[model samples]
Target: MCRWLAYSGTPIRLDELLYQPRFSLIDQSMHSRYGVETTNGDGVGVGWYPADSPAEPALFRGVGPAWNDANLREIARSTTSPLFLAHIRASTGTAVQQTNCHPFRHESWLWVHNGSIREFAKLRRDLLLAVDPALFPTIEGSTDSEVMFHLALTFGLRDRPVAAVERMAGLIEAVARTHGVPAPLQMTIGTTDGDRVWGFRYSSEGHSRSLYYSTETAALQRLYPDNPQLHRLSEETRLVVSEPLGELPGAWQPVPESSYGVIQKGADELGHFEPAAP
Candidate 1:
């Protein structure tokens, strides 16, 4: 399992979430409170839509613990973006390398995950075969997360992200059943395409990992009228995280079990989620 956070709203320094909070993503890399593993130090990565060129997202990843990465810290303090995702990896059953780090990117989209595809070594071949041949070549790492991303792309992520992911899950579970893995998946995923952010919580079994989104900006402002940061953000400012960054009352809402939600410009959407036939 891993720890990740997706942020979309007003442009702000990456460290504001990656490091400033009491229980920040960087802090989670060393002392996570909710993840299955307390320390997610295998690797780290972040992808953000640059302020000058929001259409092009930039990635800064390293095969080192984020807690001690001077370069990552330096860049985080200097860069500001309207949307971004940062992840600290705790490899489930794969090699610890730069390519295997999360916040995986494809064109303008970025993705991160906090769970695993059980028995991935057994199902990897079948899952890989289902990816579009054109997109298969883009698969740079042997992570179930990376493979999952490309599978979503093959299923039409660019045009219908929610549906594509449902189809992707359907196929994985179908394949897992054939191989005798009763509970084949557990995941809390976050994804975005520069414009909108989507977060999902689901598993083959009913219980899934934790996923949360910040309360609406306007509401938070009313609750903490003295918090200057809250005052600076737009009503749409949002954050989707593997866990809450702090203990602020009513600041984070758990995404419903087996559900998905989107944080975009207009009113955000929350809906039941289930695997659809591939």
Candidate 2:
């Protein structure tokens, strides 16, 4: 299990969200409230799309505990972006290396995941083989999370994200069935193409990991007019996280089980999610 957060709208310093909240991602790295593990210190990574238009997102990753890393702190304090993703990993079996950390990138897209494929070791070979040959060469790590990212790309993530992910999940389950495994997927994922961000919560079994999205920014500002942070963000600002960052009573909404959410420049959407055959 792991923890992550994706933010869109309003260019703000990373530290404002990564460290300023009561239960910020930095705090979650050492004391998570909903993740399977409280300490996700195996590694940490951040990817952000600059405020400038049509630019490739920049990335920074470290194979170290985020709470203890001076470089991470400095970067968070100095950089700002309109869209960004931050992740702290808790390896399910992969080596603890920088490349294995999340917020994986390809072209302009950035992705992160907070759960694992059940018994990934059994399905690894088949899953790897199923990836598009062109993408296979770009996979730099051995985590099921990274492989899932590539599989999504192979299935047309750039052109049709939601369906590609559905197909990826379907294929994983199909392969798992052939190997006598059950409940093959468990994930709370965040992905963006430097424009809109998509978040999902799903598993082969009924139960999935925790995922949540913030209430509309303008509404929150009205409720807590005295809260300066709320005022700093624009009406389009939104966040999708592995858990609530603060205990603001009406500020966070749990993503419905087996569903997907999209956060964009204007209106957002939450739609039923189902895995279809690839």
lDDT of 2 by residue, 1-278 (tens): 89999999889999998999899999999999998999999999999987776469999999999899899899999998999999999999989998899889999999999899888988999999999999999999999999999999999999999999999999998999999998889999999999899999999898999999999998999999999888988999999999999999899999999999999766798999999775
For each candidate in turn, the TM-score is 0.99, 0.98
Please list the residue runs of candidate 2 whose C-alpha ends up more than 4 Å from where it truly belongs after superposition.
none
Query: TM-score of predicted model 1?
Result: 0.99
Candidate 1 lDDT tens digits, 157-240: 999999999999999999998999888989999999999999999999989998889999999999999999899999989999
Q: Give each model's whole-structure lDDT.
A: 0.93, 0.93
